[model samples]
Target: MSLFAKRIVLGVSGGIAAYKAPDLVRRLRDASAEVRVVLTQGAQAFITPLTFQAVSHQPVHTDLLDPEAEAGMGHLELARWADQIVIAPASADLLAKLAHGHANDLLTTLCLATEAPITLCPAMNHIMWQAPATEANIHTLETRGVRLLGPIEGPLAEGESGPGRLMEPLDIVAALNGAAGAVPSIAALSDKRVLITAGPTREPIDPVRFLANRSSGRMGFAIAEAAARAGAQVTLVTGPSQLTAPRGVTRVDVETAEQMHREVLARAAQADLFIAAAAVADYRVAAPADQKVKKTETAQHLELVPNPDILRDVAALSDGPFTVGFAAETQAIVDNARRKLTDKGLDLIAANAVGEQQGFDVSDNTLQVLWSDGQATLGPAPKTQIASELIELIGARLDATG
Candidate 1:
């Protein structure tokens, strides 16, 4: 579980992106969240209440005037139920209603009556998003301390492209986590420095060919976000992964295992905690071809050499940071993780299975955390949730040591 278990009310407004509500519900549920779905009448035009009911495993609340539900003022009942209310695909009309404190519908009525913090994810055409009215409404909401996730620039459903696209569901989750104080700012991390390596390192066999894992750096990026939220000053030494640097962290991008090793070693001395999450290549070409090797009908062989063991090297440092390593295994899960924990001298090792539907290139993941003292299992959930739990555990251990 996350450090906090939240009761989230997801309000779906009318928009083409209503189709994604089910995914949002699934993501939240995977994080061990208690979620309730409420939809506007306009929302039914895009997605059915049945879709939300299936994912949230709860009755969808839509009608503003259901007699039974309104026995005690249904909008007020729901308003009090939420720890947070998130308006996704918060359309142009919805923003206008919220900005003006309109209560014509159940969604607006709840928004007006609720004391929970409101978050909005605006999705619309670029022109609609940029119109003077929409911009003014967004400004008003922000001024009133409402959290805004995104109107990220992207290709729109209208066959036109600009900065009116809704943020990805994962990013929305991150934003919510941020708002809930899950990720601390650089000021929070100021007392302790963090070092993290992410993405997959390449091992070249020839001028044009190399070996690498399928790691997309999502997990590491999520960890960085979690760490930042916890108030740690983070320096991310990453390999090539197409991920934006989390706000308020320093990022250093590297390409090969050797390059990453140098960067990690240099930063480890100043770090209070070090997470070795990069999927580094185990071996590299013994000798590289000067030119790109052409395909041939004949069989061929290439010599290989071992790459530097980054975690072990950091662990061996005279005054190294608290070290955490990752074990991506195929079988013998716990045993293999324990072996790695002992062999690498890591303070902690997080192990996960990798194959067809397991780890690597997935938004969700599970982990087995092993240490000299004990072990804990996390997830069968989103990577973000797993990351948050891992950080909390680490914080507890750090407190114990102190």
Candidate 2:
């Protein structure tokens, strides 16, 4: 079946977006998805379950321990029933619950139990949305591989204009469908926000010397170009590279992994998709010497510390983004790549071998793309061509997921 026809559970938490739940149900139905509604206790206060029942033609599930809930195993039943779990108007409370892995209620408990892809569409006041606690929660969720949609910038109910608006039902559907590979529009990612990290980070050892790589940033740049051409709002967070940014793509350049980490986390929750292709330095000089060391010194024992794992951190976010990671392995290509995919909590990972012949500082590339349950391979072609095919695969995989 088309991914859109797959079963979905619409999780309505307490928020103004609760009022929009009926429209959301209708929209999912229109997409041919079999959507079941799960309302939080707070959500019931804002909108009646009957409203959802009227549109979905299925009973709404609300209580965690209700006897009427699927032979009294409602939570478990719903958990297994979902192909995707969409928490819309995901309030601060809901975000917090998922971030800390607190299954205190049916909605949160279902999130913990389901193997389905989870997408959170946050809605709240601008200040609360931007609060440090909320941002931290978002970062945690994203790192865990949950997909986060928009709290788009616009007028708010609290007489403010900023970044805490629940996404429109159509836009949310488009985002979900786009990721599922069902993007019917040729510009499948049109209006979708995409964040990409590329190039090699420089880890400094001294004023004059630093650790670096031979990455030319071509693959990441190509992906950004293809995404922009597909009508996505693309943000490129690149390490120091000689290449220029693609037209219509916003570029943010940094020299170190730490900087890249900050840049990515700051904007992660706001994105619909995140592709991390940067060959970030795994370690940096723990204490980079302020001044260059003089020549003729005995063998130096420079201490090194691990750099922030950018992809892992991004994947850690609770409602982060549709994250894609790239694995550059020199041996055991599939096994190593699959390990990274699971280890990093990525929605998808592109694996390729790197050496003098195939990848790294090369003009062409190839990839073995892996999701949690499937895989695909792209060619040993030019980086540009490889990027196009990879982007297509990404769209398809995303379309297939939640």
Candidate 3:
């Protein structure tokens, strides 16, 4: 398969494998890719920019503040220039920065600015790679749809054989080829209409303010993307979030719980499957102020009224789609999910813990899925991976029952 004229941004971070970056650039070039090199500050200590420039025959981008770069918009320029990004020797620090959305350097900044798919070939010591924090960061990156090539099991720079070695240059090239659609595809949900809800609904408190939850909508968005990849006709009804729509899916934006309810109910009749992934607000202001509520000396007691339950409403439909619901709970996860699955007339329910670190705004998640006759556990992975697994399960159940 030809990768002719593909624009590739290869990032070299600090590690002993930094020396191998030039070889990686050469391999990409041999595949007919136009490659640009971005050297992290630590990478400069191991492999000089001159070596990369000499090998790739292109200017190496390192500094985030270079003035000569496209009118001092160097980072933005590089971000927009790439079709794909491959970061080899992705250090622990770099991974942490990416996981937490830090953009202190050009590499991390470009990763954030670019719309391109990212592939990270992590190179770290075994202990560091296996550390809880590092694994968490890796999970976060994966959840955000950043593809990881291995820190495969092999000899490490410390002369100890274990996981953490970067994948070989040629192997990396093959992975890149697979990413570019040269590999055979999975069409599990072909021709199925999958309707999904996502993100946290915002309940207005006033004209200028609202109440919302901590949901990042990552899990829901991940499911939508996975369903699209599975060749399902997907419609995403999302609340306020900064996420982009997945390929081949339609997105309908809504805010308050009532708005999401209307959108989901309007489209639920046409769907073959319905996944209620949104963290819709349970309550809203009984009567929102027409103007911004003025701060008062006396404490104000805002009254809250229960919002319409979108999941229950959809599941109550006479011939509704096979419905799935999500229960993000702090305790009794399985019991609660099972109860919801029954009470809401859902075909399936997924339960997970939500706290400061485990769920909600965090990158990775774990799930316990419950259905009338079966169950599955997933995650402690990138939410995208979890979504992929969950979508497969959904497909299987549909196939079995259909």
Candidate 4:
């Protein structure tokens, strides 16, 4: 139910995502939950205990051996104190330690000693996440009744992208609270057929290379999941992504923008809703080499041609499904979103500013949602949480219109 008075022992392990742990503490406190933090030795390199202390308004713990703490029985006391133990940025190393019964550190020791429910929000590189060792450890933890939130797909701290980004602070809080009965599922899209697109469409340059964007398809997949959970029969026409299709949703995999266009239009007529979340290439090489092109000393230019405007095309359909569009803008986010909302004849549009630090490849994003006569700002939170809110709004609007 409410996080009110709930005691949450947040374990921050060594990982780039550990920086987000302080914000998580604030979110917990905002929800009226009492939070105590435990940082692994590796975690301290990324963030200091003082940061957690300031946000949590409590002392930070990092050692299994503390002479000042309950005469060196501190780990057991913390174990007894918690109603829940949440490990955000649960590094691959920590997961293994927990799985194999390692208790060398205070966090691991507390986990072994505690009877409280444990939830882990795993954060690491996508490759590591897909590793057999990690998979086996996850399976073990799940069988032992441990809960996992996400190492959701998106850009990572390293200059690469995939699933491994930590769940955002508010998102983790929402999930924790939701599981505790703070929120209930709504069958808002019950019996509705929903069509969605996700990820980045790749336009061929040659057999060996292509043009693509930074979209990881996380937002689209999340919407597919949330919509499915809300009782919609969803078909996700996704571009290249490592994410598996959400449970209970149908999946259609495609690559280039042309392919995505074909797939969505072919199924659009049967849908009750269409969400165009893919970052489809606006243009493609006019002529692609049949074989890989040879590098030359002189610079070369590519002849580009415009790709089909899938959103505009869908929105133009007579009596089409309630159409929703996404606008990824580099500037003037609200104005651009509003213009697209009107110009494209979209029922609704969600826009966000995307750049090096925001939107495109990252796990967390903010949406400027616009319609004919109304607007709302959602997030600056996790894409999954934003998807849930947007789906709820879509359902309400759909009901109002009908």
The C-alpha RMSD of each candidate to the native structure, in angstroms, is 5.7, 16.5, 15.0, 6.2
Candidate 4 at residue 348, lDDT? Answer: 95
Model 3 spans with C-alpha error above 4 angstroms: 1-188
Worst 10 residues of 1 by lDDT: 181-190
Please give each candidate's TM-score.
Answer: 0.72, 0.54, 0.60, 0.66
Model 3 superposed RMSD (Cα): 15.0
TM-score of decoy 4:
0.66
Listed per model in order, the count of residue pairs whose N, CA or C atoms clash below 3 Å is: 8, 23, 0, 1
Candidate 4 clash pair list:
1-180
lDDT by residue (191-224, candidate 4, tens digit) is: 7999999999999889999999999898998889
* Local accuracy by lDDT, each model: 0.83, 0.84, 0.85, 0.89
Residue lDDT tens for model 2, 106-167: 99999999888898989999899889999899989876777776676678887887778887
Q: Tell how far residue 153 is off in model 3, in angstroms.
A: 32
Model 3 lDDT per residue over 352-376, tens place: 9998798887656899999999999
CA deviation > 4 Å runs, candidate 4: 1-27, 35-148, 151-171, 177-183
lDDT of 3 at 246: 54
Q: What does the lDDT come to for candidate 4?
A: 0.89
* Cα lDDT of model 1 by residue, 106-160, tens digit: 9999989998888888899989987999989987987676766557666889999
